[model samples]
Each structure stands twice: as C-alpha cells, then as structure tokens.
Target: MADTNKQSSEKKEYHKKATGNALTTVKNHSKENDLKLYGSCFCPFVQRVWISLEVKQIPYQYIEVDPYKKPDLLLQINPRGLVPALRHGDWGCYESTVLMEYLEDLSEGQSLLPPQPKTRAHSRLWSDHINRHIIPSFYRFLQEQDQQKQVTLADELKTEIGKIVDVADPTGPFFLGAGISFVDIQMAPWVVRLNRVLKPYRGWPEPEPDSRWAKWVKAIEENEHVRATTSTDELYLDSYERYAENRPNTSQVANSVNSGRGLP
Candidate 1:
C-alpha cells in the first residue's frame, strides 16, 4: 500500500512535457486537427506511434497527456488512459502496435508493411516475437535487483534479440533490408534506449562492432524519424530512474512486469 502511494506521488511529480527534439516536433504539430495523438514524450510506446506518424507523413496535432492524471479527453478516447491514443475525427483508438497498423491502413504514404501477403505475415510474426519475448525480458532485466538474476535475465534478452537477427535480412541495415518497415518501427524505440538507459544503469554491454546487432543499432540511431521523436539522452536517463531502481510504480509496463500480465 505504501509503495503504491509513493509511486502515485512520483507519477504526479515526473516531467510533464517533451524536451529537446521531441519538443520541437510537438510545437510543429501543436495546431488543432481532426487527427490527433495524445502522448507523453518519455514513453517508448508513444514514441513507436510518433515515429510511424512521421514516417507516413500524416498531419496530426500532438496533445501531451499525463497518464496518471487521466484527463477527460484521454479517457473518452481510451478509458484505460494511456498515451499514444489516436483520435481520428470523432472516433479514437489506442495501443501502440494497433495504432501503427491503423495509420498504415489510413495513409497513402510509403508503405510500412510489405506488399506481399507472405512477407507481411512474416513481419507480423516477428513483431509478435518482439512484443511477447524481447520486450518483457527487457523490463525484467531492467527491474531485477539481484546480480545473478540480472545476468540470467540479460542472457534471455540477448537470446530473444538473436532470434530476430537470424531472421532479418542479411544485406544492410533495417529489418527488411534498406527500407524501414513495420518491424523496424516496432523495435526502434527500445533499441534507442538500450544503450542510453540499459548500459549505464544495468551494465548492459555494447554489441560487437561489425556485427548485425551493431549495424542495426547504428541504423536506428541514425534514422531521421527516430531522431526527431527522441528527446535528449539525459532526459531519458532521468525519466527511467525509477524502473532502474525497481521502485513500485503504477506505470502500465512496470505493473505488467510485476504482475506477469504482459504489457498493456
């Protein structure tokens, strides 16, 4: 009970708006529009959708929301009160991956998913792998306090990542070769944070140079959409301190990790 209360208090006190490049992007999209994205800069899930909107060149208004506060408009769009909620005209939708697919269907921009059915299905399969395996392992490793457990959790994460690498195109960067696709956007946000948040706090090591992991990391780090949506490194480090310390928090991801309910 005390831990929950502490976490609730911290949520109210955390940074409430975007910083650095993300803030600039927010300003650019501040005008009212029928297409809107309710998001918090600190959230990787929100970043996923943000990157998609940029890649697809969809015009949208950015409405920053504090998830803990559960503003009325946010609740109307998503009763769960999560960010990355999409308000299209009178209707709305939430869930990062769902919104990604929704944007792909609604837009005429460069396709994020493959044209062929088989390849598209393959992409979706790996995306599921990322969500079900890689992501949960990431949180578990980040929150683990015991050194021995951390090592085990780290290995689990690496192994899951390796599965994706094995199946990814062997030619150049990005999951499906030179072009960034749904798979790339799906995993990019976490990849962005791995070095910044995980390495310093969890002692997560850098991938070997010239390796596929290294190449892919470089690609995501350099991607224009990823860069535009990301905030300063210091901001991410500060925002994720509670997760690194394994503090009891009401964050959906953190709560999912604690309760073994999978990500919300």
Candidate 2:
C-alpha cells in the first residue's frame, strides 16, 4: 500500500510539472523543434511513434506514464487517456496510427506514406486493418487466464497475424518497400511483442517475420535514434512481469466466473 501510494504521488507530481512545461513550450514552439512523446511501456501504439521518431532521426523527450493512473497534464493534453500522445509545438496529438502521419510531416527521410494516391490508399488500408483486427486479438490473449482458452486464442492469433503480414507486405522487406514505411513503424511495436510472446508461450508457433520486415527492423533499430528505446532483453521482460503484477488478479476474475458464478 505504501509503495502504491508513493508511486501514485510521483505520477501526480510529474503531471503537474508536465502541464506547466507543456503550455510554456507550446506557446513559443516552432517547426523542426524537439519532439515530446508521452507513452507507456505496455502500449504498442506508442511504440509506433517511437519507431517513427527513430527512423526519422528526430530527437524526442520520452515521458513514461502509468496507464492505471495517468498524470493530469497527460489527460489535459489527451482527455481520452490514451497512450502514445505527442505534443509538437502547439499541436498535441493522440492515437498511434495518427502519429505516424504526423511524423512524416515533421521530418524528412524515407517516405512513410506512399507518394501515389492509389498506393497511399492501400497503405492506409492495411495500417488501419492491423489496428482494428490484430490489436484486439492480442487483448483476447492478454485477458485469458485459463491455459486452454489462451491456447485457442494463441493459435487463432498466429494464423491471423501471419495473414496480416503476408497480405500487407508486398515484394519488399519493408511494408512500403526499399525502406521502412509508416506501416513499419505502426506495426513494429506489436510485432516485437507478438514475436516475443510466441517464442515463450505454448499457445503460438514460432514467428517467421517477413523477410523485408526482419531486414527493415534490423536497419531501423540500428539507427542512433532508435537505439535509445532498444534495451537489454531483460528490461523488456521486467516490464512484462510488472504489467502482469499490476493487473487485478485476472486469474481470480476468471475463476470467479468459473465457479458457476459471475464476477461481482
């Protein structure tokens, strides 16, 4: 209880400080300015912006926020209480998929959105599909407590995930081709977790990342900007454990429904 209280207090303080800083900075911000990304380790969506910023070689201030208890400033900027919110100059934006488009406008490097209208439309189509279909599927597994249900979800998830990858990735390594595209940034975070989860969990088969995605991720990950987010594998593992610990004993919730009774 003490630890929880301390953590909550710190979040409150961070929120206060962040708000004061955001208004002053936004009031006098300019283009090509330093970027600020408020994100959670658990949010794959935020990871999208992280990858975009890295690929664009843009420097950003990364602020970690708690999804359970968000800071006031974060809520002030994004009332929806979403992760991966970004503040660029006076403009504050939320939603991981949308942030990809914003990154393209801020920095120039490889084009994330295709130049041609037809091709760009195709790109957006697949991008939206993953968020709509693929992400929810992950939640199904995340919520599962019974190993049997988890296995079922995992199997279905693997098949569906493969289709999403196979269909979206054209002939190139990157979803957009020769280089990493907005699709790459949008999908990479979830891909990393999906691939990692499959390796250790019995529910899913080992992942076979598309040739292009594998190569593109390697190259993009090597960039100086991307390196900041990449850390020892142990760090990622600790984060996963912390998330599980934070959740209200989901197993208990599942069992409550299992005992011929519903969650109360």
Best by TM-score: 1
lDDT by residue for model 1 over 71-118, one digit each (tens)? Answer: 999999999988889999999999999999999998568789988999
Candidate 2 has its poorest 10 consecutive residues by lDDT at 12-21
Task: Give lDDT tens digits, candidate 2, residues 136-224.
Answer: 56555655667777778777676666665676556665676666776666666656665444344333443346564455555555444
In model 2, state the lDDT of residue 211.
61
- C-alpha TM-scores of all predictions: 0.94, 0.70
lDDT computed for candidate 1: 0.90
Residue 96, model 1, lDDT: 94
C-alpha lDDT (0 to 100) for residue 195 of candidate 2: 44
